[model samples]
Target: MSASPGAYRAPGAGLRALQLLGIVWTLPNTLVGCVLGVAGLAAGAHMHLRVRDLAIVFHRWPWGPGGALTLGNVILHTGDTLDSACMTYAHRAGHGEEAPIVLADHERAHVYQYMVLGPLFLPLYLLCGGVSVRNRFERAADRYACEGRSWWPW
Candidate 1:
């Protein structure tokens, strides 16, 4: 059968192993995402939960987790979601059907970022620029997700 527009396949064992390591290393910031979940609840955002591959995902959040946390070194939004240290929280996107797959790949790349950058990802991500599609981190993540397919809209 043909795959849907945004269909995705899970990463292999080696990548999953690295993602596990990243999850452990980035726990401090992941806790921040938990807090935001509470905040989102208080603000009346309904969180839809799921486990996809390595990250726990929260979808359909009302208020955003924010672009970046100043002191926490936490990133709360990527594309239409927040790719935390261990979990990815997202809201519904008005974009096309391919959005989920695209965002998932990009966020998976962020998990790798946690592995590579450890405590420095935030500073460097901001130094390059924030979460714009043009930012180095975002661009790199996009590239990582696409696996050099070179067919992205951003």
Candidate 2:
């Protein structure tokens, strides 16, 4: 899952900060699979209504073997944060437009969203309780990025 355009921070609680290189959310992660789920939520992490409102705060990659942290993070939820805290996926090539640029687009959007709507509408674009990972919001982001940019990974 790579970062797309329409994805926004989800609402929930206790955001878990994650790293893409070492903490890859993958299969073979069974009963011992971090319990609460994989890579999204971590200890001492909580969504700040203020922070989440100000930023999408995506932290978890919640998808596939080689999860796109930048793309995937936008769809993750922890109470109110989109993710514990935004982090990039490990595979640079998978990131499509070079990791840094991909990250810049994805993370910068959080800032833009904050400025445009003041984080009040974060959940309006998110899929809560009713769905799991890779729901409407993520799909929307994919659709958005699929515009003219061939570099985006759906």
Candidate 3:
């Protein structure tokens, strides 16, 4: 079952076990995100735990495209705040204006993707077309952000 956008469901014991497995599976990518996040921290970024997503977020990251990037369970946000607000870039004229895609929701989808793909997510993301609307991963993430469901690329 899928939760509403920005809503979080508490995990039961079985789900917790699965979450643990995902954490281990995505450890490599998580480590890479951590290294970058720590560097950002050293550069004056602030760190916060997003309890709902079970992810680490670095706000005011000194370097980035002025939006956000998700690597494993870590999200590096260029802005001072990361919330359920729709991202400027994700907004388009005459498209889903009533229910714009939320930035945190989108990145959370990437976190889920990382949990499933682990080390392969980055390579496959590039192979599918990096950071473009045409990319399957991006599409899936957008869908998840907009509809709050179906984050899987397949």
Candidate 4:
């Protein structure tokens, strides 16, 4: 059972500050995501919002969530199953609600990319031929997400 609307918890002050930093860090991208999010919300899409460490995460299905992170830390979760941006499936698994838990690292990597590459990240991602680990952006994000993790089993 999901939490009722009355049960929704507001993020803490520190998390709100970090969320502000993220908005400043990503700027235009965050703005775009906000616009999209607002539109989705206006259209009656169900929203799940939270702060995962330093990032403000959201889940609103029915717009065909791409299971990838975009606009810094904003995750577009449309799939029935959760997968991190590195293309790894969720450790425990869930519907949209589990996205931040599963895809936080991967999405944060994209946030870093937005910081480093600014607006260029998008076009470069496009120019690199889009949506594959073969793409430099995707590869970099994967590396960032997987950093310091031991990969032996899966």
Clashing pairs in 4: 65-78
lDDT of 2 by residue, 1-154 (tens): 7534434466344433322211233212212223333344454333222233232233333444433222222323333333232323322325434222223334334333323333332454353312222333333333333331322211
Q: Return the top candidate by TM-score.
A: 3
Task: Please write out the lDDT profile of model 1 over residues 1-154, one tens digit for every residue.
Answer: 7543235567799977876776777777666666775565565544444345244444444554533232122333323454322211222222222322345555655655655566776777777767664466666655554453332223
Segments in model 1 whose C-alpha atoms lie over 4 Å from true places: 1-17, 46-50, 64-101, 148-154
Per-residue lDDT over 32-72 for candidate 3, one digit per residue giving the tens place of the 0 to 100 score? 88899999988899999997776899999999668889988
Ranking by TM-score: 3, 4, 1, 2
How many residue pairs clash per model?
0, 14, 0, 1
lDDT of 4 by residue, 80-121 (tens): 333333243322232123222335555655665665565666
**Against the unseen true structure, what C-alpha lDDT does each candidate score?**
0.50, 0.32, 0.83, 0.51
Q: Give the residue spans of candidate 3 off by over 4 A.
A: 1-3, 87-98
> Which runs in model 2 stand beyond 4 Å of their true positions?
1-101, 128-154
Q: What lDDT is obtained when candidate 1 is compared to the true structure?
A: 0.50
How many clashes (backbone atoms < 3 Å, residues ≥3 apart in a chain or on different chains) does model 1 have? 0
Task: Give the Cα-based TM-score of candidate 4 against the true structure.
Answer: 0.58
TM per candidate: 0.57, 0.24, 0.89, 0.58
Tell me the deviation in Å of residue 56 in model 3.
Answer: 0.8
